[model samples]
Target: MKFICCGNKGSMPVNDNGIPMDTKKETEAGEPKYGLGVRHWQTFLYFFALTVAYAQRVNLSVAVVAMTDAAAANINFPEYDWPEKTKSLLLSSFFWGYVITQVPSGQLARKFGGKITLLTGLSICSVLNILTPLFADWGGWQLVCALRVVEGLCQGVVFPSIHTLISTWVPPNERPVLGTCAYTGNQFGTIVMLATSGLLASSSAGWPSIFYISGGVGCVWSVFFFIWGASSPAEYKRISPEERKMIELAQASESTSEHPKEKLHTPWLSFFTSPAFLALIIAHSANNWGFWTLLTEIPSYMKNVLGKDIKSNALLSALPYFAMFCMSFVFSAIATLLNKRNCISTVVSRKLFNSLGLWVPMCALIGLAYVDADQSNLAVILLTVTVGFNGACYLGFQINHIDLSPNFAGILMGITNCVGNIMSIIAPLLVGFIVTNEQDVEQWRIVFFIAAAIYLVGNGLFIIFGRASVQPWNDPPAKHRRNSTPQVESQH
Candidate 1:
């Protein structure tokens, strides 16, 4: 049986005897090698996962306006009292469960392989989405909220599992491009949901059809993913010996240590003790607060503040994410070029992109706050640019997981995302409180100010504390031993 190795550099292959040999030597010795062979297909698999997950997740956002109107139309008759507040709660309820599961979900991924964990999560989410339409008779608002929570809990593992797979499968050089591709799914999914849901919801089938459509798509995708995706390169049958050798060589050149058999005994005590980790956590939390606040509430904002019709609002809301999809690849390519050229340290490069990304959004938020609702088109343009700029930050924060510790990247991502998702819970509630029946400009202004401040602070922490150095714990004992050895005398 072949065992996998992890190290500061990346992943490596070891012989059955546990001796380290160059990947080239192994290939020469007729041992199998894995490279980028059929590896691009894995990217497609990940893309599919993201596409389906985001489509399902964003369906609620697309359905919210229609559902609210439906509830209001039936409110006068008798059985239900569906206030706007209840509608907002139903829309936001998913994040509550999503936030609670991030950490545990990551741990579970570590316990299981990414393939199993991801398939399970997607399966559960699909089932819940299908059941969502069924719950309409049980007071649609309450039923929707309950199902949203269940769906969120199941879906919470998606990001962490994706991170784990990337760390295990993708070469460090390829990570920037792959990361961008994975995130672009968010943009694409949002676009598809917004574009299609409006038409779907407008029919007599109403908002539930949006859920059914998205759920059906997700279930279909999940079946294909389970059939196709491998847990790691070792498990992939299509990878060629030459490709495998190249992958092992690239991974081995970076570090000597092998992958840990157990999960990086997350130094929880040390994590708390280290200011660097704390700062990373805090920065990500703040960053997510701004991100989620905008994502979850943008459709509602367009509808209520800009006075747009549902179809128009959906189109406008999707514009920013569409721009983001285009920009993410561009920005990631630039970052990777800089990395290849050694033009700047990894930390510096990541921070530079992150700073620019956050600053643009900060300025855009200020502009958004000041814009008159009458100038809805102008507001939409500025907001689109703001969210588009937000995509640049992924080069820093998203890829930093692998940069820091290839072995524990998944776990660290879990920790960061779990903490970050608290913002998701907070964002919708904050928006609900601020943009009530009065539609107070002052309240919305307060929300924007808070979001801007969070982004600024998060960026500051990243600049001050984030480092791209592979964590010391992930380094091999061999390298340290070799470095520590004293020079020997030449007796001759």
Candidate 2:
């Protein structure tokens, strides 16, 4: 359940290096405003949406502990009696529909705006969540799978839509902080859902409450999001004219156009052929393999292998995400401070953080593989550290797309994520095939080893080829023919 936060240029401005410049001037109140006016609030709501999205995504994993006849908490609730293989399908089911919409969703966001794309997706997903329990009971596992696919398909628009929104609203200077903060909601949401899901399952009302509560919350968030969320700063109602002017000016300077929106275009051929883009694709896929493995299966591991009761299983399952949430702030601050001081190039910093995020987890997985079941505490510590270190990916390849192409970021993300999530489809299937016996430590060790190999290989490839600078293709087709010459494209 590792997640990404997007970053891009904003009004305060940035140099060609993607570092924030002090473009702040005096306001009417005799003070300097560094961040975007209403855009920051928009960022918050986006964060909230992402949080609800993940909560819906993972709640099933927690609820399923009490869902099947194989395991129970305190109450004799309704049982689906689905086997391990069936559970794997249920968990991975969301990815099928999720994979379908990536590219189309980006195009939709670009044409219709992120506000609608995001709202429509979340609204559908929330409705589906509310209805899931009834459908699962009546239609059985296949129905559950179909429902998950629909949810995934709808929610799949989320990441790319966020990319489109950030590119249009967030200034490059403010991206590291505001964008990262918005994305950290994923970690926070996972922490809360993982912790509370078991309690809800153990409640007198049973597992249905998990879906009911989470789905209800998501629906509520959608209402506020519809009213408050805007695709770009210019569309926002409460934004000050000065703030809007800065955003417009900053966008124009970077794109070399009075209307940067009109200048935006997607270079389909170039993106597919990009070595740098391929590196990110590999990194993203490998990351998902390891991450989805933990997110989808760890609760079962805690309950069956570690012999923990339902309450402890839920709390312990949540611990890694809690560490991850806290560490996101630490990782963001360090990235900000280093970028501010110019201590390292963005290229070097991105690689450093991305590698750190992957490599530490790789090592931890190896340790988790070797540790005995009796040493559950040590294994949990390693899991926490592994996921916590992964928070740095936000500063790394997650934001690297904006550095690659601010305008086409949504499209790039759509492609990379579509490909990467294919791993999500396969990871759960592979886990089901590999660990046929949920209680076997040796089977689990094989899973850990495979994740480690992926992390090692993926990070190595990225280290060899990843880029933090914009590609030449990211420039407008008729570059110098435009109103202004962009700093990156002028040299070309």
Which numbered prediction scores highest in TM-score against the true structure? 2
Question: Once superposed on the true structure, which residue ranges of model 1 sit more than 4 Å away at CA?
Answer: 1-36, 71-81, 253-259, 475-492
- The candidate scoring highest on lDDT is 2
lDDT string, candidate 2, 267-359, tens digits: 788887989999998988888888888988889889877878788999999999888888878988887778766788888888998988899
- Total backbone clashes of candidate 1, pairs 3 or more residues apart or in separate chains: 8
Q: What is the lDDT of residue 170 in candidate 2?
A: 79
Task: For model 1, state the Cα shift of residue 274 in Å.
Answer: 3.2
- Give one digit per residue, the lDDT tens place, for model 1 in 5-80: 2112355554343323233223545854333234556767788788888888888776777766654222222233
